[model samples]
Target: MTISAFQDYLNEHRDRLLADLVEACSIPSVSGQMDACEQMAAWVEARLQRLGASVTRWETEGGPPIIWGVLGEGSASILSYSHYDVQPADPLDLWQSPPFEPSVREGKLYARGVSDDKGDLMARIHAVEMYQALHGTLPLVFKFFVEGEEEVGSPHLAPVAQAHADELKSDGCLWEAGEVDEHGRYTMYLGVKGIQYLELRVRGADTDLHSAYAPMVINPAWRLVQALNTIKAPDDRITIDGFMEHVRPPTPAEEALVERIPFDGQALRSRWGLRSWLNDMDDREALRQFVFAPTCTICGLRSGFIDAGTKTVLPSQAFVKLDFRLVPDLTPELVVELLRAHLDRRGFHDIEIVPLSSLSSSKADPESPFVRKVIAVATEVYGHEPVVYPSHGGSGPMYPLASGLGMDSVTVGVGYTGSNLHAPNENIRLEDYFNNVLFLARLLQSYAGA
Candidate 1:
């Protein structure tokens, strides 16, 4: 489609398109919320049906169901991976308006999942609709794997993927869309880092005791803190005992691709109200670390009397939640095993390790035909060379569907630096959203067109 025709289409259907997106985003389909998630599954299944695809709903072991749909037909197929579920809208007061209520202001749409997955999902569907309206039939077959548990680490996806590996097989997979950076340049990521989320707990006495007894009693909080201190140093390095041994280093090709990525560390630091990045690494080096380094981050810590007011009470129990970001060859199971051994060696075997969730990392070959075509098409459509990353710092369930099924994957999206994903006031530029729809439509046409 020509630029003029694209503009004309937008002019003719902008309001209705935005309305449809807003309607989908209005569903409180927060992941891990069983009741609301069930509602989202039903709505998503109906949406796919409306698109004229035969849909299948697979219920997760104990979470939301995975909605799979397929349409069009050809030897070449692209599996679209997206999530109907969203992160919980906590700290509600931080939002300018209600998160579920899509708010448009200053040429941006503010909603919880607008920039993350919903906008991308809707844009892809819009592209499908617009493509069919203009081209009659899709150039290649398309499969949809819109799951309802992506926001929660996709714990149940592995089982489903193993059970239906044949159905999910595809020529290439279109993972979630990547974001435009702070510089307003389009970006693409070939892979995502995996994650191992676990909690560490320590116990002292069975009940809380008076502070006066602190001299005689051992405080579980101190013990937990000490154990955590061993995991990371003040220099921000993940000193997890023997954990770094498993992280696979970047290949020469990966290094070359990563070097091309723009690094505006100062801009990011300014936006985050900071003076310097961790360890004061230069912007480029910090960017490399962000992508390549494995991390043992303490997400949360809780113990005694930690409230609005001060209370001198000895805690019986202490807990610290940690998330370990894994690169290639470093599975969640390995990290857990190493951590247990490390703690045991350090004489802290009493501390229990409770795993919450995990997803393993997978990367696509930069020179793959799929990656090359995506790069070429993105350049043609976006009017600029796209910045490519070998791996995104974020973790997702892409492994089960991408490389696990023997296909490469990439991200294409409408997010900008200020999208605030997983934070309050998440948003996407209205212009970017429309532009992505056009790009996706072009992408659909750029294939072999057999």
Candidate 2:
């Protein structure tokens, strides 16, 4: 199929597609909120049904429904992965308008879930519709594994994936994450880093004490500071033993792909308000660290007060939120065990480590046939060579489809860089959304033939 023909299809049916997406985007499907979660699952199921796919709402014990759909018949199936949930629109006051009320401004749609997985899901569905409209049937068989608990770490996902692994088998899977960079160039992430999140709390006295008693009473804030120091030193290297044992070094091909990734390190640092990365690293080194190296970060720390002024009270309890980015072969359970063991050895066992959530790292061969097909289609439709990466810095459940199912999965979406994902005023460019529909359509057509 010609790119012009696909573009024509998008132009002809753009209004209907946007309307459907707008309706879906209006739902505040924050995964943490159960009601909106179920609503979105049903919405997706209904959309898939309308697209003539046999739909199933796979209910889990405590998680949101996993909407499944199938179309056409082929031994080699394309497993399309996406989520129907979003992060909570906290700090709601920062939003330009209400988070749930979808609004179109300056050729961009503004809402919490607009540019996130919702827009992505709509683009995939629209692509399928475009193919069916052009041809009586899709070029190849496909299925969707849309989950609602992605925002909440997908705790119950592996269980469901394990249970339905046979039925969900496919030649490959394309999990949804986000779209290209700010320049509209096609971007693909083959993998993502694993994560281990925890909260460390230290108890001091039975109750809050005045600062005058500091000499006699122990301060939990100081205790937390000392404990955090043990995990990561001034040089920023994590001190947890065996933390780097399972880390797999990048392959030669992966290294070559990293060199090809055009990242303006200075620009990125400026955008994120960083003076410079640790060790004064250059572009290649910084980029390598971003994709390959593991890290320990202090997300937040809660302790004594200084709000509006200083009311001196030694807080009885202090908590520190921490996250450890793990490389390949580094399981979350292993990282947690190492941290616990280190703390116990260091005599800080009193400091509790409450586990939060974790997502595994994944890496797909950069030159795999499926990956090449994705690149070819993206280049043809977008009129630019796609940016190829061995893995992504962010963590998502992309591992299950690629590493779990042994498929060369890739991620591309309508999401624009600096879309403020998971933050207030999340949105997508109007043109990006339009082009995304054409991209997916061409990809489906090309892959089917491949």
The best candidate by TM-score is 2
List where candidate 2 sits over 4 angstroms from the true fold.
89-101, 208-219, 305-315
Over 4 Å off in model 1, which ranges? 1-8, 32-36, 90-98, 208-219, 305-315
> What TM-score does prediction 2 earn?
0.92
Top lDDT model:
1
lDDT of 1 by residue, 1-450 (tens): 665676678778999999999998898888878888898788888988988888999887778889998888677788899998898889999999999999999999999999878998998888888777776778788888888877767778889999999999987888886888767789989999998999999999999999999999999999998888888889987777777777788989899988888787887899889998877888989989988888888899999997798888999999999998899889989999989998988999889999998889988988898888888888987899899999999888889999888899989888888899999999999899998888888777777452
Candidate 1 has an lDDT of: 0.87
Give per-model TM-scores. 0.90, 0.92
Query: What is candidate 2's CA lDDT for residue 229?
Result: 83
lDDT of each: 0.87, 0.84
